[model samples]
Target: MSKFDKALTAIEETVNGALLLSATLLLFINVILRYVFTSSTTWAEEAIRYAIVWVTFFGASLCARNKMHVGIDIFIQMAPPLIKKCLLAFAQLTAAFFTAFITYFGWVSTELVIETAQKSPAMLMPMWIVYISMPLGSALMTIRFVAAAVAILRDKTTGAEVKNEDAVDISRL
Candidate 1:
């Protein structure tokens, strides 16, 4: 990865972690206050909801980078090597196209939300800030898919390596 890509990934990870931590802490504190002192943070639920939305979008990009999206592997697992490569490539292409589609539509939706000037109820945050995550995450996912496709094509990687990190024993499932 280039320095820029590395930095972008680091930022994503850090932000994801921070959002999760803050949400967890806030929710915990709110719960304790409510039970112990009959007090609650009005914004806690809303903040956690927004944080979850951001986490989902950001996590989608991270999942794309790692090629961890769930996919049916039975056919590819049984196919010949060349066919497996072709199938995997086609799958990646389809994924890229879908992510690009999401990116375009997401941006359009974000623009519309911005024009409406709507805000969240509790935080009064511009709705665009939350909606913006869709396009950003979709764009990142698109880039990751395209890059994976390029690498698989240029290096002639087998699809088997795609799930190498997820070495689960099916008997347990």
Candidate 2:
């Protein structure tokens, strides 16, 4: 991968890993506190929930980067090489358009939340911070989709296929 792609992958992986790990640890601590001390932080659950939300969004981008999204590829698999390439490109472009739509509306929703000064009940944290994840994640996914579409088109021109090493072969299972 190029340096930019490597950097983006690193950032996404690190953020997702950290958020997941932190949420797990926080939940464990909350359980211990409630069981052993008969008490727990009121905001722990809310914090964990928000962390999970962030992780889900960031993880979606990683899924796109790795080409791990589920799809019915039987027809594409059976098609001629040129037709398959075109179909794949079309799929990527469609995903890009969908994500772009989400990003635009998400940003608008987040802005509205910010303007209303909405806050979480448990933690009193600004709701916009949580809502912002939608736009950010969708934006990142849009970038990934555009990149995938470009790579697909470029491969068609150069007679090369994009190879993703992280893809799982479920049939092997």
Candidate 3:
């Protein structure tokens, strides 16, 4: 991985690490308060919900960066060398295109939310803040996928097929 990729990954890790830690702590405290005191912070649930939404979008980008998204790689793994290279190239390019398409629509939705000045009932936070994640996450994912595709093409041109160690194999767990 390049230094630039390392920097971006570190930033994503910091943001998501803080988000998950805070959300977990908030929920734990909220549960304790509701049960022990027979009362709840009115904004706790809303805060947790928003935190989860933020985490999910950001986490997805992290997953994209790591190439951890679920993939049925059985076929690719079994294919002949040249065919496998072609398949991998096709898949990476396809993912980039798909994410860019989603980002475009997500931006449209974000604009609508911003223009309408929608507010959440609990905290009256501008809904655009939450809506912005959709485009932001998809855009981040698009960039990652494009990078992956370019890397694959470059490697293929140079006759290299580097395995991604970061790709999660969930069956092991």
Per-residue lDDT, model 3, residue 55, is: 81
Please give the distance, in angstroms, between residue 137's alpha carbon in candidate 1 and its true position after superposition.
Answer: 0.8
lDDT of each: 0.84, 0.87, 0.80
lDDT of 2 by residue, 1-173 (tens): 48888898899899899999999999999999999999999999999999999998889999998898876665565566677788788888999899999999999999999999999999999999999999999899999999988888877353225343454544576
RMSD of each: 2.9, 3.1, 3.6
Report the C-alpha lDDT of model 3 over 44-156, residue by residue, as the tens digit.
Answer: 78988888887887788888877888777766665666666777778877988988998999999999999999999988999998888788888888888888878777773
lDDT of 3: 0.80
User: Per-residue CA lDDT of candidate 1, range 80-113, in tens?
Assistant: 6667777777888889999999999999999999
* Candidate 2 regions with alpha-carbon error over 4 angstroms: 156-173
Pairs in clash, predicted candidate 3:
none
RMSD of 2: 3.1
Q: Which of the predicted structures, 1 or 2, would earn the higher TM-score when compared with the native? A: 2
Q: Show the colliding residue pairs in model 1.
A: none
Best by TM-score: 2
